[model samples]
Target chain A: MTEFIPPGTRFHALPSPFPCKRGGALHGARVAYETWGALDADAGNAILIVTGLSPDAHAAANEANPAPGWWEAMIGPGKPIDTDRWFVVCVNSLGSCKGSTGPASINPASGELYRLDFPELSIEDGARAAVDVVRALGVEQLACVIGNSMGGMTALAVLLLHPGIARSHINISGSAQALPFSIAIRSLQREAIRLDPRWNGGHYDNEAYPESGMRMARKLGVITYRSALEWDGRFGRVRLDSDQADDDPFGLEFQVESYLEGHARRFVRFFDPNCYLYLSRSMDWFDLAEYGDGDVLAGLASIRVDKALAIGANTDILFPVQQQQQVADGLRAGGADARFIGLESPQGHDAFLVDFERFGPAVRGFLDEL
Target chain B: MTEFIPPGTRFHALPSPFPCKRGGALHGARVAYETWGALDADAGNAILIVTGLSPDAHAAANEANPAPGWWEAMIGPGKPIDTDRWFVVCVNSLGSCKGSTGPASINPASGELYRLDFPELSIEDGARAAVDVVRALGVEQLACVIGNSMGGMTALAVLLLHPGIARSHINISGSAQALPFSIAIRSLQREAIRLDPRWNGGHYDNEAYPESGMRMARKLGVITYRSALEWDGRFGRVRLDSDQADDDPFGLEFQVESYLEGHARRFVRFFDPNCYLYLSRSMDWFDLAEYGDGDVLAGLASIRVDKALAIGANTDILFPVQQQQQVADGLRAGGADARFIGLESPQGHDAFLVDFERFGPAVRGFLDEL
Candidate 1:
């Protein structure tokens, strides 16, 4: 289980230029990614697993860490994203912190962290950066591009912005247009961060971080990530402690409170607050139909991918099944080979992460057919 | 629109001793409330409107303020509550700040705000306080007792704890037991206040108030008060000052953000951080079944109220319609005259506040029949 990655595995860094939709260019932007398995001479065997919001290039099994990768259980040697077959590449998105050129990366001219000065990013730029990373690796074509949530939106954007880059795509729990409800929720979280006095307009340097604000933001995320039914079933009105008198003391009172705190603490450590702000704003700004004259089907028609798989969770209130239906319907009307699956899972939008028994097989079947 | 209270209109403060379920006594406990119309000489024409969480005694029509009371539109002269005929008493529950004995009120023994030292409260205690208030008012019986949300729960508790108090009951958007999901949301809000450094374990006196914490709590409340669809339809992803360049150095970027700030600011001014914590915990600890050998229906059966009306919101994910149905079923099984109405409103659990046209008539019709 703790086997190490073969020394033959190669890592690459590609400095790419992304033409942002905001009428500005982000130059000297490099995407760092890793490659496993072997790239066929024609590079047609390449498969890309676009990372989710905050995930980096490390999408494959890493023996040194022993702990499985974010989706390790599904992307290992014998897993759905079989490393033994496809030449897999997972690139850190453009405006991310994991070895990618993001807010934390030094500004070329200012010689300081970009901080608030980082160019505003869009999903188009994120997809464009992935294309550059792939091109730098000398891959002319991809077998399939798979992503979840934000990554899913980026995968679709790639097909629309750069046609024929991938033969097939998998979109999990994502929408073609940013839902107003989703935007509202994200806006509240961003406001929470901005309201923190310590944020200092995103200029807080090596000082006390806006931990409280970040915690609130994560708390909001926790609410959206899972279903209300799940929370009730798991923690309900149960007291955090055995002593009824001390159950709701001046501190953490419920099991769910402690659970949310743990989530916030871990997220604050691994996630850059500035990057979170930028990425969330990018998602909020995403509107495929707007780019295509208010026609969602027309926007999807621009994609020339041969095959696509759109998956949704039944209990996903954030990105509900209707959103996925729109994506599938648009792709079908665009004359693209598309299939949609609405998985019945009580876990809500996060079912993709928790319901691996179903998701694993679906991914495996999609990849095998492709 | 602007008028003074008529010459004959009168107001009174009713104080009563409420016994706690956990033993001992909450002696100085009082239910501060006001009344409109006139009670029959036999004191049988009284209608009790239990105020919701955080609401004060100002639940009925008041001419001095010019603006309508919380339920003024429905409970005025010749209105649904028919103040022209029945005496309506709106009592501020115990552990509340609006003219009632709460954390802000001086502890009889300490001569200071109870603060964190305030004894834990439950919905039963709130109902008991209502009973005391009613008894102290020299009212032998209630024609009808109506409540919404927390108040609804309190009304049900009153029926169970003190039989023959109200001949008829109307519970809107409340549950016999606080669901786990609701408790989880409340726990997060409470944690937000406790985590604030200024909270000082709820002992923060007149010093820097936990404004940030309270703001976060209000933001959390806003999330549950309305549906995601409602927020998106109302605010969407529209920016506050879209014309302003990202380089603009000041102000919120999105309208939703500004909306949330305004809500937070208003909530912080009127709501006490500690009182919010106490009231929220009271709701979380509410479990009628817990007091009745873990039998919720049996507990409801213990109530001997005559006619009962349980109204629920279709979009209320917090206290879903199922909870209301359960209450109605319990009442019906107990041989009580009960009816359930599931109102169609997309305003979530707070629909009772905004959808006055439908709710107003339904409430009025019920009261008229009583």
Candidate 2:
């Protein structure tokens, strides 16, 4: 369960002795990526797409791997990303278990899972790795860089740390910094995994996985991913039929509870707990304010781009709509034509993933002009 | 850690074979309560206070116990409850581990902890037990019955099931029925506990207690008790000193994380895990809609009361302000002069407990006229 690499995934060998931002280095390290369409001779129509915590490099169905990808609806020939016109490259985050060099990956020197031996991961580190993938693909400058959720933070870092990497940017449900409420949620999720007896200090194997802890963490994440209004409209007070005569009095009673159980079980079975821990902590540690003399806006302003569009759902609580507004303002302060769009979708932080009607047109409009 | 009873707590032995609403009966069960001030002749000046999932019967310092109670600020000689004018009784919830008959209490027949053997507890059961204690105190009818958090649910149940039990009512941060969002949150809390291996199907002793599980549950509760606004104002991403050079990369980094850990550790040591599960489930199971054809407003309208006051903070996410407005509206539909007051306190669900400046006057303003 440590790594879940999809077929047809390509790899970029990072420079030998790749140094981590917080310290430590890895030898013979590599990052996974996948691209759709051919890069133009001038490499002016290339776009790099970074993702949230879980997704692999395979974002959309491709000829090499016909299976529908995580964002199949949003990333196809005629989809929002429009592979027919633009060469789109998606990199699996460096700290993710999805075919990336992370805590779940085997250390080349020791031939053992990095696990606790992995250096502390930060959003900046993943940003650097994504840049390496883009450069190796022979693209000196990307037409646009699109990032969502955690990827949004990494994309901003990519632009801030390595200026002129992309001509334009699209941030969906992103933030300039992690807020207290979000930190609390992520901190609790990490504790759930760490406290599980089966975690055993990150030594659990596939047969005896930290299923319970992972389930709890994923359940919490799912709850926050959507808005309460959506929950009320979808589940309401509907009771599960199984709740009527269940022997375990504390078992699932509502349809919502059953939904969470099903969703969590499906996710935790494939995702590695140690990798999840490393990535979750990295997000909590990410604050753009560090680059701005203790000001988030200044940090955001430091990232330069020719044009940008920041879109978010009004119902997003984890990365609230206000943060997107801030992202636009900060980039605009840096002289970029950063337009902000707050969609009236009830999907909360995950609106960009499901509410394509609003996000698609906004992303398409921004890229079409370029 | 099964039960933590404060000294000087008094008990009222229930009628043999006291029945529970869900099913089963207690052979020689009793409820714990503590009174402040003296009961006036005819018991016309009596007031009963029902609390949330936690808290003991001692609502304020009394002659028998000089120590401060959880609601020490809100109830005293010159305070909102004003013990000098009205005799106050606070009953520890029946399903609680605090000096009351619950999963932690020993069964009369088997002389073993009730644990899972305890009948399914509903809000109606705790309401019935509170009413019995009120009757035993020589109060034919209470002048006012105040309920806060879970207590608010019990208070409404008291008025609904036992029609003349109390003349007036006050519901603070309570709900008419459990919302899907709240249910999801509680469901995760319960799963965190049940997943702990040390819980051992509810058979673990104090030495093998589910401390990790309890810690997780308490931390989740603490996060929701206050609002994001308050967290931002109070902690604001402030880091703890210990987090600076901590060897554990996943350990506490923010002040908010430290606050939760310290708060959770203190609570898990005293609160019994089984009692927590029972009480938490009871709150989720309660729905006044059961009395009114699946319509929460109709269910609330069935309750009879002379006067009422519903108070809540605008920031409350667990029990949002809209629920209080509904309580007021439903009680008004039943012909009671129910006044709804939404306070501008950042404390959220726990505003009634901490923001005394706003709540004290609201409670006193309603009571002084009565």
Candidate 3:
């Protein structure tokens, strides 16, 4: 069973023998998504959300799921997204483990798990998979396309590949292309998993899982996800109790280390390591500059939409606020009424998920005006 | 045998069973050092240089070891730290594997490698060991004590523990205490090293060394040592040739990733993993606040020095510029003529090592005034 899925989940059958952007094809491919609220009579009130690296299609609670979601605070009746007025569709990334056709899924031809045999994936492929869901739902044009983190890149890809698919866009903590620093981080994460002997060339079973590698990768991600200011504010020179320290000299001693350990342990079992490697590598390979003859801004300018808002945190070292500014500038250059908002949230790249007090109104204000 | 030691290296034997800051003691412990120029009859021109984690006693070439040193550009006949004008002594940090008593050193008591059995190390222990070397060298007081990176913390400890041991101080990219951000980075690095099966509870022999762990740790260190801005400028969206990409799905693709790989490969075998773990943890455990009633500033105020200069790079995320500023302000609060200088170098924490054009003048100007 997929980890953390909504009961309302629906699968959209992708084109048979679907080809990936980076060469290679998947047979019997599909995408998973969940909806909140009903599409208007004319299918004019639909909004689509693409998530960050780790999230699934479940963005908020619904009568079918009856469970709070990754973005529960932002997407509910009368919430900032306002499910009452706007019908929302959230799709799980194509290369993700949560209810999506990724390396963990069975290869229809072989009747075995895809694992490393899965085709090389790109951000464009995820965007294409998402586009299929929207087209299949009978939504002629989306009211808005909202993307967070990696999803922000996917949103731009959607707007660029299919011009009239989305009326507007909201890019949260996203970039036009991957930065070298980001690429290095993802590379290290992939290395952590690969170096683990238990990974066994991506052939590990649950009993022989690469727990350490996944844990290290998760810890590294958690470290970059939040800002140093937040770490200091949350756990400044705070040592763990002696009982928790254990005898191992290298064991968790600080509160921040323990927090990371807990986070990594919780995530290691839930997410498949091979799936993580593929999704992470896809982000590293995403380059909008490829579309505009080595100009990221030009590539973004090619994305046509009615309006766009690129929002990011000031402390975001991963995607960085500069990228958001670039996204807005390029969208504006392309004739869309685009704007960039940088919040002084100390939470870094994950601010969108946790700093609701600041992000909520900005999202609501943008949607209310639209 | 020690990995890399200069022919000019000299050993200073400490008192038998020397006590550590936290508990336990080391027997038959010795400090390694190298000298440049001759000490004046009055010993008034003596300068002591304490290094960061990886550097050895060989800061510059001498007659016995004329090979170019790690800081070849900075400390020479008429360079910024002019050996022609001052008698300089560079000491390898105590817990490091560079010709110093560390986890890699044999325990005289048991006639076995200290390894995991080595006593817990602290920055203060390194500081005390350096003081012993200075005292044995017949210098009642040093004209200046210069510390870089982790050395910055050691230099502060030198002044705090043994007041008036040095007349002036130079703290480069150093912090009075470890920040939660720094602790998290180091904690992750240690985890990388310890998780490797080859580590084998720190029982690794030369043949079965934890090369992967060390490589991963070194890569993480390199990532933090340099700035993201530098990475973007140096390898922005640059891909390796197809031949170099190889067939591995998660293999190195970007120039930055290759650079890190080459660097990690070069460093992994050079430094012992156990020694790396101990020294890294020492920095994380160091806190000036321990000396000052739960206040870092108060702790700095307690250290008595005639003058101090805390210089750092603006882009240094590891030992951030704010930390150097705090060091200066704290020293000033303690009645020292301390000042802070934040350089506009793009090299991050390693600015002192690479951006000699910028750092040379500042260091020269400070010592010239003295």
Candidate 4:
């Protein structure tokens, strides 16, 4: 038996009216979200966990379908998130595949999948949708908003774009502006997808999916998500199999290669190719300073959040410790209660997911202070 | 004016009997090399400079073709290599394109280019070719054998394989064994070449070459050659052209991508795809312990080098600082006067090429002791 939402549980769909950059007037674009636990009569004690690039409202608790939520370990009873003490809400991000108005979602007018006709989505747009989800849940304000990776970036965006949405924010292993190296890497990944023969300019319905392209993209990502020293220490010169001779061409020659291949294969099965492109482009276009007249501190000043915790991993070359320092400095200059934690973890940018023993305690401490 | 190597300078084609791993034998497979300055009466002033994977015997002196030698800055008149005093010799290794017996060389049996039929060449074979070059120069012992990257690995191999060939060794960012991550990255580069439709199983003729695959390989190599931090700092989110908006479909969007593309394009023109594959494979197969019952120290014990300098760069993730430490540790354990120097440079593995101000002093200081 699995846990289920009570029959009387309230769900809301709040639509927005904003003209997209691609000349599409998006009307009645409602966000779908689910709330767990009780919101105090004063609409306080609410915690919002923003979902990642492709996840949905089912990001905390495992439902009757029983698919493990992305953050199942952190959100359940006695977990760091502790839904019993606070009302937790998560929404399907804009331009996502899972029940969101993405490329795969059907258009109301034509009754056809939006496909390549979808509007370009920005981080601001995604954050706006998240705000709508909270407002529709009858919550005037959130105690805190926490997110990881891209979701972390979105949490920062929520603070900047939506006034007084959250009292505090937790940004884990993310940056306000995507770095140039990241943009370059993501450009190559996008090229891989666009170069695929089956892509046909993102209109491949009856043909095979761009799997080879997706695999290449995932391989590039694996290189960024972990430290070279970690890879060398864990798998230096190690063969995939002990029994195979050096001359065997088809055998698993290197352990790191085998690990990358496994990750690439799994990512291809679960991820959408077009969504990957859109989200990568969104990340590249994100520059908070640019929006605030090239002053990052001014952008932080615009955010109404009372406090912030900027967390980074020492080995995370993708989102380095320096970037976290920049965020903390900017927030402090803006008179916000900002602190930074540079954790020593060899798992690189993915440390937030792997080093939960340390991360869970840090999150609990931050939330306890609130 | 650039000084040139005068025509009619005496050169030697030293062909040694090298044993191949896959049975059979190759005789008179000469290593072509050039020498500058005078070998002392006792032939004790000889300094051997081992070239990296793609470079040839023209390591210092300018050629008639107007293209500068790869190490011209370091090996010329008053430079670190100092051809004015030290008798500097550089050889085209066993499996190379310039006047060496590589895949393009003629096969003895069929009198045709070996091509795909070429034997798998190991780092040991490359070192043996260098040894043959040294012997042919009439020098009984080398004052020093200096190398960078793959060439550094070859220098280590020489010390282990032929003890009396060199009295001192300088390894610039080298590793005794290729890490699994390195092998995996190199394997993908090789596969990028092999999977190209134009590769034709390495049988592509002179007219038709795998330009796309070679470009991809170079693109991948460029990423490893430079640090992500450097890339971001130098070309952060800057568009190649200001006129192009964020939504532009064609042309490079970021400056880093353009830089990588430029590097890849230039590399394809001067470098052979087949040679890149063979050399990377040679690097992947480099493991000193494989020759001495799986004991790396035991293998290096045969080397009679008096002093060894293992140098590394701070930002070099490809051949990192720890790798240089491994070289120093191995040589020290083998009773050699080993010293480790970790240079702080932001140029990544290519720091040895660009950071000549620091590299010059380090090299001169090490050689001054001799």
Against the reference, the lDDT scores of all candidates come to: 0.76, 0.90, 0.91, 0.73
- The DockQ-based CAPRI class assigned to model 3 is high
Task: Sort the predicted structures by lDDT, highest score first.
Answer: 3, 2, 1, 4
Report the number of the highest-lDDT candidate. Answer: 3
Highest-TM-score candidate = 3
- Point out where model 2 deviates above 4 Å: A243-246, B243-246
Residues A25-127 of candidate 2 have per-residue lDDT tens digits of 8778889998888799898889999999888999888888889887778787877778889999999999788888999888887999999889888899999
**Candidate 1 regions off by >4 Å?**
A1-19, A23-27, A62-66, A203-207, A243-248, A295-298, B1-19, B22-29, B63-66, B203-207, B241-251
- RMSD vs true structure, all candidates: 4.3, 1.7, 1.1, 4.5
TM-score, every prediction: 0.90, 0.97, 0.99, 0.90
Off by over 4 Å in 4: A1-17, A21-36, A51-58, A107-115, A242-251, B1-17, B22-32, B63-66, B106-113, B205-208, B243-251, B291-302
Per-residue lDDT of candidate 1, residues B189-239 (tens digit): 887788777877777755677877888788778777777667667876566
Cα deviation in Å at residue B327, candidate 4? 1.2
Superposed Cα deviation of residue A84, candidate 1 (Å): 4.1
Write model 3 residue lDDT over A1-370, tens digit each, in one string.
Answer: 1344557778999998889988999898889898999999999999999999899898988877878889999998989999999999999999888888999998998998898899998999999999999989999899999999999999999898888998899999999999898999889999999999999998998899999999989999998899999988899999999988858778989998999989998899999899899999989888888888889888887888989999999999899999999999999988899999999999999999999999999999999998
Residue A293 lDDT in candidate 4: 80
lDDT of 2 at B109: 82
> Can you give the lDDT of residue A357 in candidate 4?
80
